[model samples]
Target: MPKEWFKRVYVCTKPFMFMVFLQTSYAVKNLVVKSALNKGLNHYIFAVYRNAIAALFFGPLAFFLERKVRPKMTISIFLKIMLLGLLEYVFGILYCYFKNGSEKKTLNTERIT
Candidate 1:
């Protein structure tokens, strides 16, 4: 297979692949939210917890799969991964906190009447 052909194929397929990914992700998110509501769980917690579970499950698989193709890891690589994980956790917490805080404010305003 020629390199140019590969590039053309990739360029043509990229949008379709992205669209499929977006649609699938949207559907999964809706299902998770609905299921959590039915189970009496808060939607924010459900979504965040679901994402954490997914990361836990896939994180190791990603490392294992990438190891076959990537260079051997060094201390710097480990540090970078740690930093990325820390950022992920911080952002996740901030998002959930803001969401829950706003929700509480709305509920409190309704109660004030």
Candidate 2:
């Protein structure tokens, strides 16, 4: 019985490790893309496109993996998550908008006419 348990654990290890590796890779790639955009992109389009692509890649995986455990679709949980998501989106947009707006204003003021 002990041997059988060990065997099952060993068999499950590879898939778990693979999932960790994939998640780490995705995080690193996202950080690199974000840094590149921050350095000189100066356009909301690039950020939006990157976010959309990431959502496209992860959304299906999340749905598939959580299909069995997904909480019974309920209004309260949905509202909670929606509110959190909206707060996050608003914070990010505000931060980026203010940062870029100030930079542009400074540059315009410094220009020789």
TM-score of each: 0.42, 0.40
Q: How close is candidate 1 to the true structure, as a TM-score?
A: 0.42
Predicted candidate 2 versus true structure: per-residue lDDT over 20-94, tens digit per residue: 999999999889877887798755878787789989999999999999987796899999999999999888766
lDDT of 1 at 27: 100
Task: Spell out the clash pairs found in candidate 1.
Answer: none
Question: lDDT for every model?
Answer: 0.84, 0.82
* Per-residue alpha-carbon lDDT of candidate 1 for residues 11-62, written as tens digits (9 for 90 to 100): 9999999999999999998997787799899878877988999999999999
* Model 1 accuracy (lDDT, Cα): 0.84
Q: Which candidate leads the pack in TM-score?
A: 1
